[model samples]
Target: MRRSGVVRGWRLVALVAAALAIAVVGVLAARAVLDAPALRDFFSRYPGTTERPEAAPYGFPAWLQWQHFLNAFLLVFIVKSGLQIRAKQRPPAFVTRRNTGLITTKRPPRRLGLHVWWHLVVDTLWVLNGVIYFVLLFASGQWLRLVPLTWDVIPNAISAGIQYAAFQWPLHDGWVHYNALQQLFYAATVFLAGPLALVTGLRLSPIFTQRDSWFTRRFTETAARRLHWAIMVYFLAFTVVHVTLVVTTGALRNLNAMYAGRHDESWIGLAIFAVSLVVMVLGWFVARPALLTRLAERGNDVRRMK
Candidate 1:
């Protein structure tokens, strides 16, 4: 009976996640029925509304520049607020788990004062950021940048995973142009985070509660928080990978793409973006132990043949 209950819990989570994904796809499709040139069309409309100069070729557009700045700014803020929510700690407060015995895991108190208030403010900004950015992504013909646009991405992530755990390199550096891990993470961010915000908002909304909506029936705010915690695994994973590479490469260069949009004055943030990318391909150099393991195994095989 206890085992059965665990299965039921897993099934419920899968069902809810599926429902959220479907709802998001439906909403995006309905919005696209308008079928303006593309997502870029929505933001392109903005250039004319403001008295800004037109974007230079291959240069960051005015709106795009502000968007990046805003994105990076909010990213830092969200990380802080997220930590305050339950900084560096994760547990019952974060996710729901299966337990048969009377023993169950618990979260430690991380009494970050004003965490309660900060959560509200940070999340509200995130929601606004999503709505506005999705609109801009649609208008700017830049969806491909966020989505997994290439087949190599999955294989790349697997290779990157191998590197992370066992410090092994499965393929030559030239085999992949983009860091497989980065591509996959960003792709999921678009698809997964997009829907999470909506469902969580509904689950917490007073208006929805008053109307006895589906969110109210399916999960309480506490349960919704748990779901949000599970989704946060993606964010946590990305942060680790992001920080590791930033320091592993050069903080200046990585900061360039994120800040001025380039390491030096040249072409803004494009060059460091390119270099930081190249650094991932050479990550095998940093984990020399993994490299020696493969060579040693090869030598052993050769000696056995002799």
Candidate 2:
């Protein structure tokens, strides 16, 4: 189960043979479509023919807005809290730890513009982002697609990794199934990062900061800062991996579908796009019971396979 034909040093070169086959087939397919008047007419009717698709349902636009707000929040909080906490250090060992590790010990914290008012501004955005994210999870059923329900998930993920790395795929599932890393990442973002950011931010707030609330309130502000930084690092890394995966596999085909909401298999792309619709209307409908049943069935299937 652990072994796969895709990931290795020489397999990349070995895969040249298969790549050539694929390229030839692709060229032929392109020419056939190009020469056929019917195909041209059909594509004319569907300008997004395997090239462009829409991803409106992903809430990419709204998410982008939220990201902007988050960046502003981070900037305000980091700067305002930085000046206040840095330099001389404080009662909590973290102030020293943060400055020493993240910043060189050579310099003191900047005192300029270090004020309480800006701190409050930072806290407000943290609260606002918490509220927005809670609503986003409910409004968007994106939670369903990313979570791993089956025990087979881990093995499958590793298998997918090996195959991809070896430059071959042993199991060509109809859908481009997610590997383990993707599932783990998506789940972590949904369940861990969002909540942690909120809790840590609030805990650092002077209004609610307290020794008794150290676990959640007045929690290690430095640790929270570290966590926030880590999340951004993860986000940046994921973006690179995601783009690289799309390109290595097939950029134009997948990107077109994501952008315009149409792909080679129109319905599949539509269904994925429809995830956004489900997000918006998930709670209002009475279909929760049936959805639960379907989830249960899927769960049972996984167990059976195991």
Candidate 3:
């Protein structure tokens, strides 16, 4: 049985490797075609970004830097706890609502597994952070960086995608204005994917699923669960590609803009990035059941199931 399992694992790995190799070859062929005179002229006409409005503001503000770090921190644990909840067959501890809280509520607290409790907690925090981000994004006029105002965005996005696939990424000034591709991606992620994830997650949660309302009737729990997983996969893929471009295009400049809220190639941004990564890693490691149970017990009634 062990030998058979090992063989199956090797076979899967080989299949994945072959698929990746084929994809690389396909991309290279497309890149060659993009190098043609007509295509080159077209690319020159639409270099990636459309014209920015006269009122569009520039520079990564301090609020954006803090929001970026907070989002990254919350996402790490959210993904971790979500996976744990999905895979855990036997929960180590279960949480029930406190009967004697100062806050009044009609529905009693539902008993949740430790992993589920943690996932919900982190998810709530993430949602609140997202709300704050949206408020600040519009209030500070930073929405212009992401929201597509012109129809030219579609063609520019296509051009930018071709440039990326061809591995000819332009190290554009993201601090001032994002390329059409970046703008569209950011808009979709924040406005579409983020909301989709939240909606699907809520649909699958005990509060929503337990009730037999129109929402529950319209969106089945099974469908919500699958969509939620797909959204998570999208987020993972986005993070990988986003980080790869950030590092490859101009690591220092990108990091400076994101972390230090500056355009310079100073080490401060890199240092901050490194520290944030370490903190995230530590949080991942420390989120074991024992620690989680202790944290969950403070507000909820926790009982050891096993």
Candidate 4:
């Protein structure tokens, strides 16, 4: 049965609350059983350093701030539309190609055309944004901050993970240096998750289904759907954890560095972030299926005319 929005929201809240409670209990239990020094030593295997040639020119740039905002904006819509598409229970609407006599909408439910269109639109924008981000990141030498240069990053990441779990909170100064865990997570998000998400999304597209090639044969639609869903879940989890860390670790400094491009501890960054958030919330309401459907139809008409 289709659930009401309020019911779904409450269920989500309950789920998150339960998860947090369980995590808190687990951490407490672990700390009770393990000696303080032993726990610290176990987690402190790999040492992180503030001194590295790769950490030159600290603080966020204007381009980085813009990219970050764009990324967040696109990701919010992408995830929302993706969830809507996945949750569609009714049959999907079909679009027929007059020239090729091809029928699309074999996979998604009929009523999901708007969601699919929005997903594709946002996905395209996200990819373009990613391309720009990659170019700027490499060109500005900021890639060095995210990519691991030494093997010790592995152990250091593990140490950071432990510290986080135990509530000890690792030292965080993103303006200057990222802990091993942050570096690895950022790298995975950029290099691994981004490409995988794109590949899996493409695999589920109508063009891929129309082609009976070896590529489609190897990466079946079923597998692609599963991977796509997993990737979405990964993104959701990462967003939650990343936001939690930012707020708990140091909200002012983190927001300042990201939103204001400054390292100073001030409320200016928070104010900007709040404004961006209001925009995002407004976007969520504005990107309704009815509105998006009209936009998609106009886009299709333009394409047909061309």
Backbone steric clashes in candidate 1, count = 10
Model 3, 1-306: lDDT tens digits are 999999999999999999999889878976886788768877877888988877878888888888888888999999998898789678899998786759546887788888888998999999998999999999988998889999988888888887787787854789888999999988999999999989999898887977998879888998999999999999999999889989998899999999998889989899999999999999999988899899888877899876
lDDT of 1: 0.49
Q: If candidate 3 were superposed on the true structure by all CA atoms, what would the RMSD be?
A: 2.1
Model 3 CA deviation exceeding 4 Å by range: 1-17
- lDDT measured at residue 295 in model 4 versus the true structure, 0 to 100: 69
Worst 10 residues of 3 by lDDT: 99-108
lDDT of 4 by residue, 1-306 (tens): 356888999999999999999999978865553346656665445544323555456788999999999898888899888888788843133222223224334454222265676788799999999999999999988888788888878877776766676677777789888888999899999999999999999998766866899999999999999999999999889999998898888899999999999888889999999999999998888986556645656424212211
Q: How far is candidate 2 from the true structure (C-alpha RMSD, Å)?
A: 20.8
Global fold similarity of model 1 (TM-score): 0.47
RMSD of 1: 20.3
Candidate whose lDDT is highest: 3
- Using TM-score, rank the candidates from best to worst: 3, 4, 1, 2
Which candidate gets the maximum TM-score versus the true structure? 3
What are the per-residue Cα lDDT tens digits for candidate 1 across 119-224?
4445677677777877877687555444555465555455455344433322322111235565566657666865785586556443344456564777777787
> With candidate 2 superimposed using the best TM-score fit, by how many Å does residue 68's alpha carbon deviate from the native?
12
Deviation from native of the Cα of residue 18 in model 3, angstroms: 3.4
lDDT value for model 4: 0.78
Q: Is candidate 2 or candidate 4 better by lDDT?
A: 4
- TM-scores for all candidates: the values are 0.47, 0.42, 0.93, 0.81
